[model samples]
Structure formats: structure tokens, C-alpha cells
Target chain A: MTTRTVARRVLTLVVRGRGAQGGVWGEAVLREFDETVTTWQALRWAAGGIRVAMRERRRRAADARRAGARWRRVSRRIVIGSATAAAVLAVLNQFVVTIAYEPSAGMQPTLRAGSRIIVDRISLHFGGLSRGDLVQISLPTPAGRISAFKRVVGLPGDQISCRDGFLIRNGVRVDEPYLPAGSTIDCRALTVPAHEVYVLGDNRAASADSRIWGPVAERDITGRVLVFS
Target chain B: MPRRPDTSPQTLLLFRALLADPSQWRYGYDLSRETALASGTLYPILIRLADREFLETRWEPPEQPGRPPRHVYRLTDAGADHARERLAAAAKPSASSKKAATAPTPRLLGGAR
Candidate 1:
């Protein structure tokens, strides 16, 4: 083979070893080699190539350091964002709607035992109470305050009485569609005073409510029931 | 692995070459020729200096078509100051050494007189 062929073969091998570092440096080396073809000059060019390979190795180490710093910054942002979302959800649950499950037959047919329900605590703050609205009440008992679910029957200043399995509101018979068929309600007449409401259960036959414990104060109502399953 | 530039003869020679024209862009091949340093010895020093921010690099476009661009380097502002301070500190003699050098030796008077 001619000297030029040999030179070309050597140059190709050296450039291949350059690999990722080959781009501009490789081209410069090849151009310089083409300008000088003597054996002595080729040896000098090989020496220069070795220096470039060492420089490339150091450059890779610096790039790794920069990448590590960027990864740490991204991880910190993710953790902060997740914590912020959890806090907002907690606030919404406390002041807005909350999910709960019915554990008794008090509000049956409308809300069966073990029914999942959503209570709107915010509604009581905006729209005030009204008759026929289902509510979660905190009833004061001898043991402690126990929570109960019932439908509002009589509002303040209304004469409420139960006669022959029916509800009497302000001396007028009121229709109760939520109550189970054939359920009987027998109780004496009593007027719900100011800031008080009479509440009752849908399963009147099996429930202990206003007839037994009397009317509940307006302050004892916890939340208005919105949805049930 | 990255390393700090040592105060070896080769390293000093390369630093002197760069410091001679602190602002001008110096090509790698030209630097190698001027300093009489092998590629293996010269490149590591340049890389270490650049990593420490004592040198800055740039790519200069080729003067002719079909020629690849060349990588050129120069001392950074901080690098020039650091090199000057380090070199000057090395050249300055310590107080004890300076006092010893200046102290006059007593002459043998009897035989000479």
C-alpha cells in the first residue's frame, strides 16, 4: 500500500476512537493532517488527539454535576405541590361538604342503614333551615351528645302533634310521603317554641325521636343532608 | 476524574504562555507548539484550569470553506488575577530568606592586610 493509503487508515482509526468528541475537533485534526503528510507531522497530530480525549473525559464529569442539581430542584417542587394540594382538600372537607354513612334505620326508605351520604355543612350558612329538609342533628343525651339523622317536621312557633298515625302541623294534617306505609305515630300536642324544630324518623314504628325526646334546638343541627345511596 | 492544576514546571510553562496575552484567544495546537508540551501533558492542565473558571473557551469559525472550526481559549477575568497573584507569590522570597541573602560575610582581615 502507498504511504497516503496508510495515513488514511491511521486517521480513520484515530477519529473512530474520538467517537462522541469527534464533531469539530475530529474535523480539525483531519484538516491539519491533510495539510501536512510527513511521518513526523503525523506523530505530532497523534499526540494532539490523545490530549483531546483526556479533555473530553473531564467535560463529561461537569455535565453530570449539573444534571444532579437539576434533579434535586425538580424533586423539591413536586413535594411542595403535593403538600399544598392536601392542605386545600382538608380545608374544603371541614367547611364544605363531608361524606358519612348512616348506621341506623332512622331515615329509612330515603336513607337506609349503612347508606353512604353527603352532608352539606355550607348550606346552613347560606340558606336557612326549612321544614321537610333532612338534617344531621347532635342530640344531647344522658351518655353524651349523639348524632342522629331525621327529617324536619315542624318549624318554630308551629303547633305539632301526632294523631292516629299522622302528623298535625299548626292544627292542619300534613302529608308525609317519606314515612313507610302503615306506620303509626301517637303523641300529645305540643307547640315548638322559638328557635326550635321538631324532627322525626321515616320508620316511625321503630324510631325514638321528637315524640320521645322533644324538640331540638336550632344550634344542635350539624348539617343538611344533600345526597344518599 | 477532575483535578486541580499542580505547580509543576509544565503547568507553569503553560500558564506563562496564556498569561503573556491574557485577552487573546489561543488555539490548542498553537499552544502545544509554543510551550513544547506533549498533547497528553498540555490538555489536562487546560481542562483543569477551565473547570476552575481560570480559562474560558470559544469556537472560532474557519477562515476557509470546508475547514472545521477550531476551539480557542483565554484567561477569564478572575483567572488572570489568580494566575498573577499565585505567580507573584511564588517569585517573592520570604522575610527570613531575604534577610539572610542581604547579610554581609565578614572578611579575613589579618592575612589580607
Candidate 2:
């Protein structure tokens, strides 16, 4: 082939190769440069997002540190206050009392079975028991047992007895509004002991109180039933 | 000192992964796998962390006589402390919206006399 024809063929191959690769020489260079620039741009955008996130995180951390310190201070104050209150309550629960208990199922529907009660043990301590107050006393424990609980129906210097399911205290037929169903006693009449209380259960038939165990001493009394929970 | 694009997040995350295990030397591919970044995105971050003195990088021992060595990275003491700060920041709530969401209030009111 002629040298000129050979040169023309070579030129055509070069053009075709450039065309297949999809660029002019300068365009190819510019495209590569653009790609490099775009990659860096994407990275820069990602880094910017990361920077904002980091800054926000830093601010939040500072705020939380301050808040945590404040909360700790508040908690310390609360702990101190609560501890002082608890100490006062403990002293009262030890020296003075404010709770009551029933000996048996005396006032069933009104009080209930196995129900413990909180009494103003301090109230009875100041002003003594009247005609009918549900009081608790430490009865005679037959050598080896704990104290007992009962209701006071008659006080010292009173004539106490139960006739036909009704209580008679000091020549008058007393009305007991707290009696449960089927309460009946066999005692006729007896003189109350000096400085002692004649106690009985609201359910006279089921109770083993002063009628069986005799009158209770004044010092053996604990308190009266006030609140039921 | 052209700010270098504020690479604190990547630096912090890299420091965390490194401090979580100080004895083992982590490479670029290991860090990329742990942090879920592509090679194109991760290599530059590694280079930046190394430049900041937050990370130390070295050529790892070759597995065989003729095998290419891997580049390993680890966090410095300052880097670990910065990571701790970043982690603390990450654990905190971002705005008042979160506080409002968590605060409790009375559900009912007593009748007005």
C-alpha cells in the first residue's frame, strides 16, 4: 500500500478508537478530571454531614453533664430530707403507738375477720377510755404466751353483766351498736374490779375474754382501734 | 490548615473501634468493615486521622515471603479520650423535643368546688 494511504488508515483507526472510547482527547481528560472532582465532592458532602452531627453531639454532651450534676444535687437534698423524716417516724413507732387489733371475729361485718387496725394509741393515753371503747390489753398469759385483745364494756366501780344477749352496765341496759350476729353470754351479774376494765368481745358467744379469763389490769392496756385499712 | 473538611465523626468512630481492642492491630479493610464504609470513602479518612496524630499507622508484617504488607491503624491516648467525649455526646438527647416526650404529668384532676 502507499505510504499516504497507510497514514490515512492509521488516522482513521485512531479516530475510531477515540470514538469508541466516547471522547475527544481534551474531552477525555476533562471527563476524568470531572470524575475526580465529583468523587471529592461526594466525600466532602459526607464529611460536612459528619461535622454537623459531631457538633450537635458535643453540645448535647455538655448540656447533659450540667443536667446530671443538677439532678445529683437535687437527689442528695431529697435523700437527706427523707432520712430525717424516717428517723422521726421510727422514734414515734418505738416510744408511742397508733395501731389497734381485734381479739376475735367480734364485729364481723363492720370490722372483718383477720383485719389489723391503726389506732390513735396516743389519744387514749391522754384521755382514758369511756363507757364503750374497743380497747386492747395485755391479759394474763397462763405462764407462757403473748398478750390478748378485747373490747371494754364496763369500767371500775360499775355493775357489769349480760342478760338475754344484752349488756347491763351500772344499773342501765347498755346498747352495743357494734355487736355481730348470734352474740349471747351466760354471765348474770358481777362487780367490776377497782382500776380494772370489764372487757368482752362484740361476738359474746365466740369470745374467751373477761367472762372466762377475768378482768384486765389498767397498765396491761395498749390502745383502741381507730382506722381500718 | 484548611480545616480539612472536619472529619471528627470518622475519626471518632475509628478511634472507638481501635480502643475497643487495643492489642489487635486493625487495618484499613478491617476498619472499613467495622464502620461500614467503602474503600473509596475510608482510605482518605484513615489518612486524615493519621495526619491529626489521633491515629498511628504502620506497614504490617507480610503473611508470606513475597506477599504485600497491610497498613495497620490504632488510636493514641488523646484519640481514646476524644472518642470517650464523642461517645458521651452520642448518648445524650439532641433537643427539647426528647425531654418533653419523657416528662410525666398527672393524668386526672380533682373536681373544682
Candidate 3:
């Protein structure tokens, strides 16, 4: 309505310009306005103050935009970092090896219970299978499907038999120090079929093995036990 | 290093005004009148100068009762030196014509839209 009133409103705008920053400048301009001797002078001062306020508001908006961009970069880095880690682990598990800790319920004595073991998937394809090596097999049990570690004792065409507390393969008694001393696990000398091997658990008393489910095919044996850590 | 503010005509005018009394505290209103700068243009330069440590500011008690305290500013030693340097450089011949200094266009603040 009046020049003085308009100047006063403009002074308010100057303080609000700090809405764009900290309001120190706005206060500075406001305090100066109080010293203006005429309404005309005050109006002129307030016009200038408005421009300053708009500049401050624009400056603050830029700062906020920069901060928003920084946050986006940080979140993107977190997401990309997690994704890369998961992919590397998946590749290692599929092609290199699978690390597992097993409570050696079936295969024991040699592989102590509660020890950590690594299944060597790479070696399963490279190295030839032997009669005394420990292997990981996926086969069926009475309850359901099972993943187990067992000792290989009978190769293809080998007649495996248990006589006098020892495991005899093709009439040659194999030295099984891992089995409990003088433990007799009765397995009739059945000829192992081609592409298969007879496997038995070292904890012969508690284990359900080839004696219960028959020999496991070579394709069914997934990996060889590399180490008991 | 502290960032240097722009060297427009208004900014040069302000430098000349402050250089007249380098150590004495200059009031914002007096500066606007002395330099013929709009309060809008005069203040942002003052705030920038203070922010860059080229100038120091203080609040002086009013001369009379009921009058609010005035915000006063004075150039620092660095600001005085810089002001002299800018004035001396502007005096020398340059690529641009002198008319641009007398009525320079207003530059936009913040980012371009």
C-alpha cells in the first residue's frame, strides 16, 4: 500500500535469502535498512536486497544438488561392490573348489570330525581315481538324498570282500589303518561294475555305505577330498 | 589457496572505494553510495570478500538510541594488496575495450539453467 510497507516486506525477503545460506547477510542488509532516512532510500535498498536473496537461494540449491550427486555415487559404489564380490565367489565355487566343514559322521578316523575340508573339483577331472582316496558322493539313502564323504576301496572289476576284520579287494587285503583297529565290516565280494567304485565309510558301525546302497557310479562322485584342515 | 572473486566493473569500483580507506571500517550503505553500486551488487561482493578472508566484518553500536547496530567491513592486508594489484592491472592496456568496464553486464549466479 505504501513505499515504507513495501520496503519493510522487501527487508523480510532479504532475511529469507539466507534460506539460501546462513542469514548473516540478510541480517546485515536488514540492520542497514533501519538506518535509511527516507522511504525512497529504503525501497531502493530493498530492491537490491531482493536480488542478493535470489542469488543466495540459487547458490544453496547448487550446493544441495552437488551433495545429492555425491550420495548417489556412494550408493552406486556399494551396490556394484557387493555384486562383484558375489560374482567372484560364485565363479570360484563352481570351477575351482567348494570349501565345507563336515562333522565326519560317516567317514571318520582319517577325517577328524569337526575338521574343515576342501572338495577338489578341479582334481576330480584331472587326477585319476585311486582305491584308497576319499571322495565326495551324492547318492540316495533310506531317509532321502544325501551328500557324504566315503573311502574308495573297490575299483571297477575288483572283487571286494570283508574277511578277518580287513577289507580285501580282488583277494588282496588292503591295509585300512583309518578303520577302527580290528573292526570288521561284512561286505560280500561282489564284482564292482564298470564305471563304478565300491565305497565304504570308515566309521563302519554307524555309516550306511555301499554295503547298504551298492557301489556309486564314477559320474555320481563329485569331488575328491583334498585336505582336512 | 583462497579462491579469487570476479573482476567486474562493480567489483573494481568496490575495490577502489575500500582502497581509499583500507583499514577504516566501511558501512554497507556508505559503500553503496560511494561506489554507485546497487545494494544487491554491493552486498554479494562484500560477503564474498569476507568469505575469502579478503575482508573482516564487525557490528558497530548505533550512534543514537532505537537505531539498530550497523554491519561494518574493512579490507584485510591480503585484500588491500589484491585490490592494488587488480587496479594496477586494469589500468594497463588489454584486449577488451574500456566501455565494458563502465557498464558491464550482470553475470548470473549459481549454475546455468
Candidate 4:
């Protein structure tokens, strides 16, 4: 095609991009192309018209966005976003998993004071309690109830006792590997009742557990410490 | 109001060209040739001027056959006054420079041209 025809088509496109108000300006640009000394200059002029079309399009878009802006539109988005996040966290906190801070040094050597732990709430409900499982359960306190982290030393109908600085479960000498060497425990032998578990802290010397408070009901176990962690 | 008139060097050149023929309605190409501004740069400035009611525009039929009508532009009275004010402000820095050469303390100039 000839440069004149090509330039005319391009100028037409630029005018269309500019929309209604730009049609007049587009005419001015198109008419001036014929006055140029050469076809090349006409093409260049048409090319330059593209810039005007682009600028007009951008300006119109910005103006439309500004005109349609309202507080309700922006505020609704924020509200919905926050509500969705809170609801998801709530479900995760209730059933899937929960974040807990290890409060005191009762479970020392394993969990330090002020350490953070992820408790798997779903596992305890799905998988039955096993011996040596670290579990979080609520224990009665003077004011109300308090959560405690301890290792289950005895399960339902099992005999448990601390003797000669070692743990004995079901008449078998169970090595207390997690505890500090030479740690001593002198608790009497006790058979864990049905639907209950006997628990103790890894720091046997410093813990107040089943030896002093007796067995914890299986239903009272809140969650298990994540095995992966 | 349509905001302040553009006072860039190129825009000032356009203002001067228009002021040179304030009474005559001139075609876009004629003004572009006089001011040496490309059509792309020229049209947007004219649109802004028209939007601000600083320039008036019209359509004039081509004298020959098989030719489209031409867009002709002339500055309004307000545009002429604005162009004059801006031109005078632009000249003040040079005028002040000559005064500074004779004065003991240097005086700060006003807004940028």
C-alpha cells in the first residue's frame, strides 16, 4: 500500500483510540498530513498522533476511576478480607492445629520455658494415646483451669512407678533416656485406671505430675505435640 | 478555573506564535511551521488551551475540491492576557540580572519561567 493510505489508516486508528472528544483533534492531524512535504513526514506525523491517543486514553481511565470511587466500595473489600482471614484462623485453631507457648521448665530438656510449640489437635482424636507421647491437657487450678504439657508414662490399665532413678512400666524396666543422667524418682507404684493416663515431665526432679496429682482422664488430653516438630 | 496555563519553553514558543497573530485564525500546520513544533506536540497543547477556554477553534472548508475542512485556531482574550503575563515573568530574571550587577546585595529571583 502507498504511505499516504497507510498513514491515513493509522491516523484513523489513533482517532478511534481517543474516542468521541478526540475525533476533532484526529481530523486536524489527518488533514495536516496532506500538507507535509513528503509521505515519510506524513507517516511520522501519524505515528506521533498515537502518543496523543495513548495519553487521552490514560487520562480518561484515571478520570473514570476517580469519578466512580466511593468509601463503601473500598471499605467493603477490607471488611470481607479481614473476616475471611479470621474465620480461617478460627477453624484452624479449633481443630487442625494450635500454637502454644511452653510455660515454665516442668518439661525441661525437651521443651524449655517460653518455647513455642505446635499442638496437633486432630491427631489425638484420630490416633489413640501412646506411651511417651507429649500431650497438652488442662489441670485444675485454684482460680480456674490451666493447660500443662507432659509426657504420658502410663496408658489405661498399665502399672507405672518411678524407682531407682528409672521408669518402670507394666513390670518392665523402661529406660528414661530423655531425663538427665542420675535423676532420681521415688514415687509409689500405681495402676493407671480405665480411660486415664499417667504423665510426668522430662525434668522428673522439678515436675508436679501424675505422681502428685494422679492420672489424667483421656478425655482431658487437649492435643498431641506434632511428631514432625 | 482551568488551572494555570502551561509555561514550558515549547508552550511559551506556541504562546508567542499565537500572540503574533492573535486576531487571525490560523491553521495547525501554519502555526507548527511558524513555531517549529511537531503536530503531535502541538495538538495536545491546543486541546488544553481550548479546554481552559484560552483558545477558540473553528472548521474552515478547504478552498479546492476533494480536500477535507481545516481546523483553525485563535487565542481568546483571556489566553492573550495569560501569554503576556507569562512572557513578562520569563523576562524578569534577565531584567533582574542587570539590576543585580549594579546593586551591592544580590536579590533572589521569583518563580521559575
Q: Work out the TM-score per prediction.
A: 0.48, 0.37, 0.55, 0.43
lDDT of 3 at B108: 15
* Model 1, span A1-229: residue lDDT tens: 7665565556546655546345344444444455444666566666565456545645655788889989999999999988999999877765688888888988888889999889998768667789999999889989999988989998999999877778899988888877777877888799998988999988887777899989999899989998888
**How does each model score on lDDT?**
0.74, 0.59, 0.78, 0.80
Model 4 chain A weakest 10-residue run by lDDT:
A17-26
lDDT of 3 by residue, A1-229 (tens): 8888878776785567336333567667777776577877888888888777667767778989999999999999999999999999877755677876666577767766676888887666666689888888888668876778888988899998888877888888888777877577787779999999999989898787899878899988988888777
Maximum-TM-score candidate = 3
Model 3: colliding residue pairs: none
In terms of lDDT, the poorest run of 10 residues in model 1 chain B is B104-113
Model 2 pairs whose backbones collide: A99-A119
Q: What DockQ, between 0 and 1, does each candidate earn? A: 0.17, 0.02, 0.48, 0.46
- lDDT, residue B38, model 3: 76
**Candidate 3 regions with alpha-carbon error over 4 angstroms:** A17-22, A93-149, A152-185, A188-229, B1-9, B47-52, B58-70, B89-113
lDDT of 3 by residue, B1-113 (tens): 55335567888899888978788998999898899887888999998888899989998998988876778999898887766656654554362534434433222111111
Q: Which stretches of candidate 4 lie over 4 Å from their true place?
A: A17-22, A63-229, B1-5, B64-66, B95-113
Positional deviation of residue B86's Cα in model 1 after best superposition, in angstroms: 3.8
> Which runs in model 1 stand beyond 4 Å of their true positions?
A1-41, A47-51, A54-58, A65-69, A76-84, A87-119, A122-229, B1-6, B89-113
